[model samples]
Target chain A: MSLDAVPVAETRRKGDVEPLVRLAGPDMAAVDALIVERMQSQVPVIPMLADHLVAAGGKRLRPLLTIAAARAAGASGPIEAPVRLAAAVEFIHTATLLHDDVVDSSDLRRGKVAAHLIWGAPSSVLVGDYLFARAFELMVETGRMRALGILATASSVISEGEVLQLTRAHDLNLDQATYLRIISAKTAELFAAAAEAGAVGVDADDATVAALRAYGLNLGLAFQLADDALDYGGQSEVLGKNAGDDFREGKVTLPLLLAAARTRGREDAFWDRTINKGERTEDDFRRARELIVGSGSVAATLDLAWDYADLARDALSALPASDWRAALERLADFAVSRVA
Target chain B: MSLDAVPVAETRRKGDVEPLVRLAGPDMAAVDALIVERMQSQVPVIPMLADHLVAAGGKRLRPLLTIAAARAAGASGPIEAPVRLAAAVEFIHTATLLHDDVVDSSDLRRGKVAAHLIWGAPSSVLVGDYLFARAFELMVETGRMRALGILATASSVISEGEVLQLTRAHDLNLDQATYLRIISAKTAELFAAAAEAGAVGVDADDATVAALRAYGLNLGLAFQLADDALDYGGQSEVLGKNAGDDFREGKVTLPLLLAAARTRGREDAFWDRTINKGERTEDDFRRARELIVGSGSVAATLDLAWDYADLARDALSALPASDWRAALERLADFAVSRVA
Candidate 1:
């Protein structure tokens, strides 16, 4: 299918997402099919709950990075292995969201009720495991040891990061170093593996694999930073979840962390009350947003995102010029531009 | 090492467990080490929570089956592949236990507090995922896609089984056929995979793999049947879980399903009130036990277990003669004898 065949209304306005779909358009459709095929089971709840979460509208960005990275790595044909791995990548992400909702006790996901709330935490948790197992099966079908190792390692890292985030949830003293470590393991690790697996799927050279991993890692960090900023400032439509979710949950993202850092004297008490102690009113979220913007942490967070996005773009220097490569660069810009 | 090298105290009265330990003694030690090594992580809760469950003394029957089956299939050497696979098998089992407890809302496991109760359900859910990922990584490191495929598929089947069990939980009308299907997927699938992976680890012939799978499938059926019986009749000290755990959970195991089938009139109402409606008085358990025994379901369940054990023993006819072979046969007897 050509870009010309795509309906004009369906075109993504986001700079990063557009190039991703445009370049990997045909392959992603196949990946989508594979994902749907593999997630089905004789057990009804597995499909019912899994499909509910899948339909909740995650952008499939991680898998897109996978397909695009593989194409850029010289497998330009309609190959099946990377497409399978891409499906696996999406499965892993969806599994995490399912488990995280149970962990955080969150009711909302992607503008819908969380799977745990709808089907019960047990179903969400088990189906998440099912998807994860399915992910490995797909990776194994890739018949690539490197891809398996990268994903398996990423799964462990993501879990570790989640546990770290759980432990450090409301600590007013959460340092930037700890926060970075948490995000690197929880978010960036899978992103890095997703892209690296794409290159490795085609047996790309070590240098290319390393470059893709770096690009994905930095892109993941940028993506997460932008997510943090959006949590405080963006609308529910843009956020895909309710705004001020992090505040109510007392999650200390960069904007909140930075804003707390900059606050002094009387302002420290407010941070302590709202975030540390979880004492909040309907008006408290407005006040928290005001302090977050007033202290310039939102801008600072976007700046940090921009810096990471730049790093992500620079890492792509090793890849040869291609539509896929350019799209990845644009993805870095779009990640930060969401906050803009 | 000879059998005399084993200490007198180490001899197991159970038909199967002794020879497994005696035959695979040295390699199992290595598998234990791998389990410990792979479970370690920088995030404290992962290792902390995982180790707590590992130390709680659930018999490592699943991993031992993998190692012993490998030995039976002619890999007698202290090869790292089977050992790693065995460790991976244990990790998968333990991870399921962690998640299953959360799903079942059970408070105790293996005479110790379940991980979900201790660390919270979310931690168990997430850490279970970490261990699962670690399991796949170990299988991949074996450089055997077949092994990875077997384990991964088993994981999905097991999750499917868990969901089925959840859906059918309070339905006293659940039949022998549906119950068999659930146990086969949830319990036997993993056991079968564990045995088959052992054979596949040595690149065993198709005939050999099929024989091993058959052996494992029958053994798992026998084992679960005995477990159901034990839940009704055995002591907590013997079962390693509380007696009447199924009764309290209202889980419709084989014994209960059979008893419910046999019961009529007022007895039917009793089961309906207890199992279906979740209304139980303290003395109702005592009366329920009497009804189950009087109904002869325990005897019938044990007979069914014996039949499966016979099938398991028969499946071993394909394997070459060895001590491991004899041990597997004895293990089959021990499975049925547990209920007897």
Candidate 2:
């Protein structure tokens, strides 16, 4: 069931997020309602713009993971703690998206116009700040100081990762280690914290807490690796998934790093022209996609993704036998099987 | 005497910040060192970019106010609480500056090239985030949960105000009440929080906390109003302060709002062309300045600023007459006299 060799399919597995959603189903609605309530303000634009993005569909994967982790650790406490932390995680995630779209000049997110596009960049940045501040306020409501510290540290690490990525833009020398480092901070930090915060909410033991953090961290790495591969053209024979047009944007993800590593710099300047200099044309995107697939970098990326997914599975070995734990195990499978 | 009719003077009064600094002098160094220490990280850019802006100094007025207020309220704690909160306040201010430059597309800040100009918009945005996150970390170190809540709420309100201003940009119909609302949230929230947090650090009584909050809020309003007037034409033959440029940048502050209110619809379209459309030239800035002065909005802005200064003075009437309280009272006078 290895997906490394898959040619062109890269859509999210339909039920990958569902198992966790169902496991955490009880608190999902409450988290969603709380998000809407906390984001409210007298400033009409605050709610209008926030709702526009918040309501737009995305798998509520992060919060679901938080709730599941909390439950899997045998926390029977009122469920309020996990619910609040889940909402806070969603706020942080949404806030980052708003800022990211502005930074990337993204025209669309989740199939709608980006918030920046609709509200303008200034509003997007400012509103992102609003959401960020709101996220902390929600964190404070949990009254768990340790959980607050985890989320706050994650926020800082994520910012540092973003800065690193920004500095490395168009940098042809980006290696696997550096790419992993960046992704770990930008993407994995929140995932790890989201799960850890839940465990903290329930007063999970240190061993269980560490296990949950590891689970989240490795799963995040796997998730990002799969995403990078999908962008380069991960498709199944039955599905011909759209190769995400990331190379054209000069994004230096894992596949691009592998592709560059394999090349001998013969086309370094040409790669530089499109990927580094941002002199992109439609023709360049097609050719870049061809290079990525032809070089077997797609397979390499997925193989690496599988390795992380395995680590994620291994992290759960110490957890107690429970339906929620089993669901988390299945979620790991979905993380790697996206391309299969 | 009010400085309304003065033209071209716009520097903060020389001793306004000094008294507070001297009063809080003991903790100032530790706060400075802590900021440099906490901002350090594995990511070189975090420190490099943070230092670039942090070192290119402003008055350091906010932190001084925090420390002074803590001391004024008889804070006998380790002084660590106020020091940490002071650093956090400064970080928040710095982070906002980084983001504000990107939103405003300004090339210069503190007479130095903005970090965005040196690095880029993405770095500016992300590093601002790093500082904001670091701010919370420092806030947590105080272990004064109530103080943390105050700072967190201020951060949210500040962002809401910024978003409100962004949404209201180029809006010619912005009224006095709305304009005040925007500045109060954008600028005054932090000032009020800084003083309130300092008092909270000392476990000050509810009455003392109220007094400090009121003092900071009115001082903030007076400071911002003077700043607004200073940008238009607040100067004297002796002071020769540089008229801070706001009109050319399309900011719709109190002076411009008043000026627009005074003008009839005939010139309204002309104002729209320059302010609303952001179509400014050297000649336009000059003309805008002339229009602002000719409308007598400058004097009116200062008159309103004096009202806030008086309120700030009245807020301290309840405090025990300490040297620190007198310094704060003098600070209000200096806020109004900056342009005189």
Candidate 3:
């Protein structure tokens, strides 16, 4: 499922076309350009700050979903709506990362000093607020009620998730249900919103809208699960962050949750030492990773992720076959594959 | 104006009579109840923490404006729209105050412990996020695009104004224009939004919207200016906090802006003693107050406040002459007279 194996299918094949790639190309371009233009307006400070983060570069997967969903729904001509919505999504994501660094009190982001460490906490907080404001303003300009509703709901959900995450942090007894809810609200909501916005823009039928939403939500959940797994086992160079960053921060990711469950009675001491203990060193993190891996939690979690990715692809089965739809399927494969 | 003089206003005035007061009674009741209801849902830790600060109530003036404006337009089927909007405004205000206390590193709010001081910094930050989320959810229930637009824009403006205010802090060179823009965006934008939401809900005409916007904007400006004057001159009992909190925080309020202009030769010494010098005591604040008063800056600022109040009343004059409109007129008078 990971991108390590999927050949970059060229020019859309007979049956297996890259629908998301085809549909999202212009949309991503629009979003990319808009992000640069809007972010550039913050003269002397905002632009530079924004650029430093943008240059660190995420996968741009969320914008891809937005554009692909729009195109899949028969949207054409200008399509400024999806682009703007995509940019707003990215802004919200970036703002949260900025504040998250402060909340986590981390020093590094994408192999560089986090904004808080570089510019200070006050600057980070204000800059995050600025980005949030900028995003809302962009959303308002779209003048779409459905779009506004989706984005606003996503935003509130994101905040709720963050608070939930914070509340559950360092509490090893936190259940899987709570963790899943956190990820759904914190992460999947945006992906779902991004995809749904496209259909909303073109005034797509309810079924199509629902289908795209399902695709995005499943894809997002799978994507986050893969991310959680990779943070435990993947390389820092590929991921743009240190391995076990979550473990170091005491976050209860999927692997840790599974590992905790596995260690319930047999390895209770190990759970207390690695999971409950806050004073984690390089060796402690390493051993914890080994414990999680040995418990088969990582592989089991990957299976769950693969299932979700499959479901994501299946959600698009009802749509008419198109080059853009093919790319969405590929993107789902890539979401899981990339993490694997 | 001080609520001490007007007391209860005897009996409730009918349609358009005593717009602010009539609006105040019901809106306050509704807002207070909603705030309490929302505050109750903060869960394990944040609820009591938020309540501690929420109970130290300031006048629910922003919510009053929202409900009053809607009622003044004669839409009384259900005050739900304005009530929700009012709650949204209050939530935003509370979130900003929480962040502001942290930013200022202050220990007091309305003669009680600040949220950060009482609940710790992390709790304050997370709780602020909680309130922000709650506000958005409330907006979603209202289902008005204009309301969404106004609330989102106002919240952004507040943040921008906060950033601007931060940069201008301790810098005596801040001009009247920047001062007005900061306070207007920070304070007036929400008030304007609250009023605008009222018109938006009832689908009032553009002229009515414009008039209400103008009234809100002018009133907000006058209120802030008078607030600044009170920080330097009003007694603690009436103001609800110690005088010169602004001075202690090294904020360049309107009175300070005026006083700085009048200082001429003593400018450097004055700023140096008051702003550049950190960790001010009561004696330092007292001397700064004396300097500001001796310069006639407070009086000039008060005159400016009256000017804005007059403009507010002028805007209200365009509305139909109802009792609510009359109450709005008194609210204009109240804006300036509250601190005097």
Candidate 2 has an lDDT of: 0.81
Candidate 1's C-alpha runs over 4 A off are A1-14, B1-16
What are the per-residue Cα lDDT tens digits for candidate 1 across B1-340? 1112212222323465787778777888899889999999888899999899886747788888898878898885567788899999999999998999999898878888778787888788888988998998898789988999999999988988899999986688898899999889888888999999988998889998999999999999999988887777777877877888889988888888888888876588889899889998768877877777667777778778888888998999999998889999999989866545
lDDT of 3 at A234: 80
lDDT, model 1, position B41:
88
Residue A91 local lDDT, model 1: 96
Q: Kindly list the interface RMSD, in angstroms, of each predicted candidate in the order they appear.
A: 0.9, 1.0, 2.4
Question: Candidate 1 at residue A192, lDDT?
Answer: 97
Candidate closest to the true structure, highest lDDT: 1
User: Compared with the true structure, what per-residue lDDT tens digits does model 2 show for residues B145-234?
Assistant: 788888889999999998888778558778878899999998988899999999998888999999999989998998888788777664
Error of 1 at B70 (Å): 1.1
- In model 3 chain B, the worst 10-residue window by lDDT is B1-10
Arrange candidates by lDDT, descending.
1, 2, 3
> A27, model 3: CA deviation in Å?
1.9
Which one is best on TM-score? 1
What TM-score quantifies how close candidate 2 is to the native fold? 0.92
User: In angstroms, how far off is A287's CA in candidate 3?
Assistant: 2.5
Candidate 3 structure quality by residue, lDDT tens digits, B53-86: 6677776777778877887777766778788888
TM per model?
A: 0.95, 0.92, 0.88
